[model samples]
Target: MTSGCFFHEPIRLPIDLNEQSDTLKGTDLIRVSKFYKDSKDGRFMSFLHDDARTLYDVFRKGAKESNNGPCLGWREGPNKPYQWLNYNEALLRAKNFGSGLISVGLAAGPHTLVGLYSQNCPEWILTEQACYTYSLVVVPLYDTLGPDACAFIINQAEINVVVCEDEKKCNLLLDKAPRCLRKLIVIKDTRPTTNQRAKNRGVEILRFEDVERLGAQRNHVELPPKVTDLCTICYTSGTTGNPKGVMLTHQNVVAAISAVILQLSEYKPTYKDTMISFLPLAHMLERCCENAMYLVGGSVGFYSGDIKKLSDDMKALKPTVMPAVPRLLNRMYDKVQTELQRSCMKRILFNMALRAKEGEIKKSIVRNNSTWDKLVFRKIQESLGGRLRLMLIGSAPLAGNVLTFARCALGCLVVEGYGQTECSAPVTLTIQGDYIPEHVGPPVACCCVKLVDVPEMEYYAINNQGEVCVRGTNVFVGYYKDLEKTAEVIDEQGWHHTGDVGMWLPNGSLKIIDRKKHTFKLSQGEYIVPEKIENIYIRSQYVAQVFVHGESLKSCVVGIVVPDVDVVKCWASENGIPGTLSVLCNNPEVKRLILDDMLAWGKDAGLKSFEQVKDIYLHPDPFSIQNGLLTPTLKAKRPQLRAYFKPQIEDLYQQLD
Candidate 1:
């Protein structure tokens, strides 16, 4: 490995630090992008292109610039090649669909809301664009939300019509159809069984293609939205209570796209790039990224709806850009690491190659055609489609070791971003060639970021650690029909109080350290941030997912640990213990082994005695969205987790006492 790598030195790349700086403004406590520091009105960019004022305008511009280029694609069947629709074709369908909605009695204005109840697909984008064409606000509905949550959104948003992916979802909506719902549009053919129930409920059922044909017969003119017109009501997946609908205006989303364009100016997206869309379109991160791609006239292909086949879809699409959540990336990292562990020689070669690549990364150089890449990382690169050049990770903080492994193994620009739905996805995004892990890069051009003191949590802005606050055109207007909730997050001075605590690094980047809402006090009045402690314990090889929990009545924290099945099984085999993972979870020896490892990891990570978990319950089942223990974005739902493991938690506390 050394002989092959020694012949070629890593290439040096030019870097402009000024372009990536977040300038502190006149001792104002807020930091804005350097590119907009000299502006007279102190406002960042409002739109990426003069021709694109609204989301509909962005699509129209794409059609004008790349009319014959592939716009949306999806596979017709398993292992089949992806079929595509060019910009011109997609535009026609959107126009027809918008007209169809009007013909079906939906008012064409910002007041009308259309619900999209589907997974990521070409039809989902078509329906969204159609809504944009007629100034209709879109409200996305997904299955992970369950029928009850879906019903709540449908009733709360006053949605009259819902577009479902298939008859199964159509039936799901029908089962809990709200009184406000008047019509159902099924993307697939309407089943005979659905017709009777829909009719009995006094709601009209229409097929997707029939609606298009109906619209084609009477092509209505576009009712484009103004800059301040309501574009969407994105309902956040709350871990605790009923979801709140975050109202985002055309100006808000457009400014967000502009921010992405300016931040990635040096490595701008172009018409030649293609992205495989797998992340939930309901989430702001995926939605914003897709809009940015559309603005640049790039192609977007949907995953086959089954996550198990995502790899097959990636290989088929060979996409150049990927927007992902940390959970997916973590799985990829774990798989590769497991594969390399089979042979000592293979692991040695991979380590040598990773070292060489990391050396280049430290020098701010990223390239996929280096000797080490070709010799050792070629297989990994090809696993995600050999053409990948950029990977955007968000929704959660990625582990430092996993982040470094992704950059070195995938041979691409792995940019970590930090944001929430209130800010329209990206508040801070790492610049190209910045391989440093654990810190999300400086603020984007559209918004200003500042840290405010949180006294109870002991986080202070003066010390460069506190609750993160953002202010700009990209901030959402308010929560729908909930003025009191809106006021709770957005202050009078126009700053949106992000409930996450962050620390500013010396280089101007922001690192998310803890969550403000997840803090709990012990009986002795010591505050414990469970998320922070869990992050440390998750580093243990035996732990898959850990949830640290404490009660005000308890003196110390307790945890529920989901043991890593493979790692635990391997350990049991080496130690001459025998059982399935579910059985071994109850074994005294296995429990002791895992607890000791977690304690060692916590001690090594500088966790204090009070902060460390005093007792733990080994859980064989992993937390997941379907089980209601995790959100759709794969974040642990603390309240739900507590409710789910109430018995185990009580046992742990009793044992500790």
Candidate 2:
């Protein structure tokens, strides 16, 4: 039978069930989208909007549907009100800017790559749309990628013209002076010396306004891309070695957009819906979500370059949809918990309301219930602008308790998804009403998922636990200029062998349990998945961040933990132990307390003795992108962390021995 949003309903089951059977048995190993169950190969055949073939078509369709609606918005500065551009106005500018590219000696074609070096801003989207008009592929560069990496991408892509946010970014690029680069277009004013430096480096510097004016004078026609044309080359932020350029085509991105539209069809998005963009636009998660918003004629506002001011931006925008990563959500979760602990009565009342709402959640009903919402959760909801209805979480695993808390407190459909750059950012997503944690729903509409055995890790398809492999229109064509690496990931049958290990739940949802590449065999011949262990340890109230490490020669694992500063401070104050965080990190008593709590948590979760951490070292400072210990996506860079904490890790092992 069909349900709400016909596209979301599974038309046919992969496996047949016997009516008399007690247990639900899904015999089929491969999982395909319900919408395409009748198809021979179950490949994605159409987009939600049939006319929307390329990214440019998506914007044009939105402009036609919501011509006078606000399309893009940006703040003048911190605490400033957002300024906007209507859909028609933005489209005109995009065309003008695209024509400007041609006027400034950039040839329009699929082969031409245009570098976009900027934070999330209206200018960035404009440049992206502008490139779409000329069929030019966009290559994004971010701050986390140092000058050398940026220059490497520039040379590899053979980019001739780059549209930078300001003079500082232009200078950073010019400092590298890559041979393939010829022109630098600064969005803001460029100094005389900056222009002179570019000239000396055998490149021309031009103002963004000059290019737009030139385009206006020329009035060149739009050269829209075909469905098969290359859209963008998103470079993955590698934890080790150089980044790989993932090549996504027009069809790939459009299919991804279709999957989102199909999944959220019940919500019926319109121009009134707004999203505040803060995540780096260079990532596929933000890029794909923003495109989906545009397809629905919705508005988007850019956060101020400063992440510290994101809360202020949220207040101003009052966004209906939020795209988030677990790192940010975890911080929010910590803040609310810490605040609740300040008062006994407040904590009791909050728990009472949370328990009541959680009861309703178990019934598959998610809403801002009148009584609890108005009395207890209203302030919490208002903290995120009071208009949030949906939050899409990806990049990393979110604790189940935090997921439950966010749904109860925020009164939004907090969905957790699993994806990577190779699949246009969403392989699976939790259904709108499913409150289950750990599993990332079923395969998205554009893709079918299957599992392959990893004998080395003892995972097998027969047990429904193996490496997750995806085949779909959403998958990228190949990594740019790296056929050998491409062949390593994509098999002969076109399945992209995602390095992630997954288990198929009874309800058909996929649970990501381990990483194929990140496993290490301990001395006792037992394998350890450090990420899985770390996730368990991080659930401790006193633990903020953790890195679990095990060596081949070691019998047990050790950890480096960064404690929750506020919680730790509160504990210290109550215990009459006075010291700064740095000093307290070295306090043996504090260390012992944290370790005991984490071990207790591990035991409750049924961890084996060898799986539990044998010893731990408390760190005052959190692993951050600035320190090169975490990726831009906030995932720990294991190799970097190991190198940085080598001495501490050795000490932990020595103590354990």
Candidate 3:
């Protein structure tokens, strides 16, 4: 399943589902073809169906298909191995939980919103399914969310019940939750007070076991949602404003799942296949993808909140498939390559293999070398538990070299896709083996994509760039209560204004160029795309993080760069640059070394003259979620970054002047 010629009406890739993927071992990977013909008509995936109207529908259908197969896996603690729940058992528990909600006086309907505030856990999935089965809107809360943000969403969504992960979370909500919130359901035994004591304060506190017990004694009614009924009020972790709740319906979830599944049809996921869940469940990407995995009759393994434990989890699970952000993929690639660099012969051999892959990709036919597979690649693949076949990369764009190295060295199909929290996960994904150099696949099967001409900076099809827009069943309904904000993005035409700058490849894949709002024109009338430049610059070995900025007063861009520790340390050692990582990061010589290399990488990436970095300041600290520099999806917080770097930016511009 590989080719550059994507039809407006998506046809299946070249792979045959009936036969096992021939790609397991090959002489040379023959790329389907590089010659692409463009079509204006938009295509949706082949797997889409009007069948399931709700998440409950997906679960029930999966239960029927998977039968008694294990559906969910979670650990009791950081040190424990994962345990499983069979589909039939899970379905029964959900039915009992639904009945339990009724005993607790929690009515299931469109009017009631249940807030699920917790980390990823089996209990969380049980409660989430219980909500859908009872037709209640489930609002997910990030465990790391600030108190004020938590309070805002709980009140605005009118949460009827709060499902906390543990006692500490329950106590945090006790003081901050809106007075209207009625019940606190704790997954653990610890609570803010004794159940009777908490009830006297007008909030009933009950253990998870109590709800299940009460429901087990009652008969549960099947309450399914209409396709159009609201499902979740998913809050956006906005970098510059309050979180906006994007309302998703049952149809939206189905469409998103079907579209993603269509792209995945070639690689059938049977019950034997396992998936690891590490992304925050509060995030739409993880939630919808997990549901899709369930529908595919595969099991899901949950990771403890600690990221440091992910490698160990992967080793134990040896999952065939995993969903990842760019950070995770990069880490895996870096870790493996860094270890190889420890040996001179290994590094030389790895480079030779990398060069071979680069040549094969250029020719569109990669010759498979059993020697390379058995020698250089075998150990790395085994580290991931051997059976791994797919790593679905999304959330943000990854460097093309990173994508290539991942596929070649990591021994997995690295499928890069384009999407946002609002799109329910994937708007477009790379066809199984059709890895377009640097492009996200054509618009997904359920989505119709087009570029709306942006004339303000003279950006139009003539220039090969425009604002990317998507319309489909998978698109969200709207912002929960803010129609004004809603109308601004979703037009009367039903197209979602993605606010992303993109251009289509000859083969119809979409190449994201810049963000609509991040484009700033200098006095010279040239547009500067911060993310576009930043992406190119970050590929430099010397750079770890960067925030590029250009003002109307400036003619070129200035950046705040966080140098890579290992790379900088080696450079310091070789060039007689002094000081430890913290000290050297601020050293003038080290800054100059990084700035020069960044410019070189930027130029190599085809950045325009105006987009090149003319001035840069090396920041000692890397931007992180804790400092408000990244969104949960790991995108740069542009507004926050600019504000934090304002003074330094001004000084850089003055120097340029």
What C-alpha lDDT do the candidate models reach, one value each? 0.86, 0.85, 0.75
**Tens-digit lDDT track for model 2 on 1-657?**
101122222222222221101111253677765434432256463477777878999987877767668999998887779899999899888889989999988899899999999988888888999999999999999988888889999999999999998889999999896898999888889889999989999999888878888998998888999999999999987788788999999899988878866766565366668888998899999999899888878899998878777888888988888899887878887787878878999899999999988876765566664588889988877777888877899988888888898888887767888998999888887776676677788777788788899999999999989999998889999999999989999999999999999998887788898999899999999999999888888889999899999999999999999999988998999999999999999999999999999999999999999999988999999999888899866788999999999999999899888
Tens digits of per-residue lDDT for model 1 on 1-657? 111222233323223543455455456456777655542245777887888989999987877767569999999878799999999899899899999999999999999999999899999999999999999999998878888899999999999999888888988998889999999898888768788889999888898999989999999988999999999999997887888899999889989888877766656567878999999898889999899889888999999989998888999999988998888888888787888879999899989998998998887666677888899888878778788877888989998989998888877778888998999888888877677788998888888888999999999999999999998889999999999999999999999999999998877778899988999899999999998899899988899999999989989998999999989999999999999999999999999999999999999999999998888899999999888899765789998999999999998877777
lDDT of 3 by residue, 521-589 (tens): 888988777887887888777888998888887788889998888888987889887788889966888
TM-score of each: 0.95, 0.93, 0.88
RMSD of 1: 3.1
**Among all candidates shown, the one with the greatest TM-score:** 1
> What does the lDDT read for residue 238 in candidate 2?
79
Best candidate (score: lDDT): 1
- Model 3: runs farther than 4 Å from truth? 1-12, 15-51, 77-81, 191-202, 355-369, 462-464, 573-582
Clashing pairs in model 2, backbone N/Cα/C closer than 3 A: none
- Write down the RMSD of all candidates, one decimal each: 3.1, 4.1, 6.6
Select the stronger candidate by TM-score from 2 and 3: 2
lDDT of prediction 2:
0.85
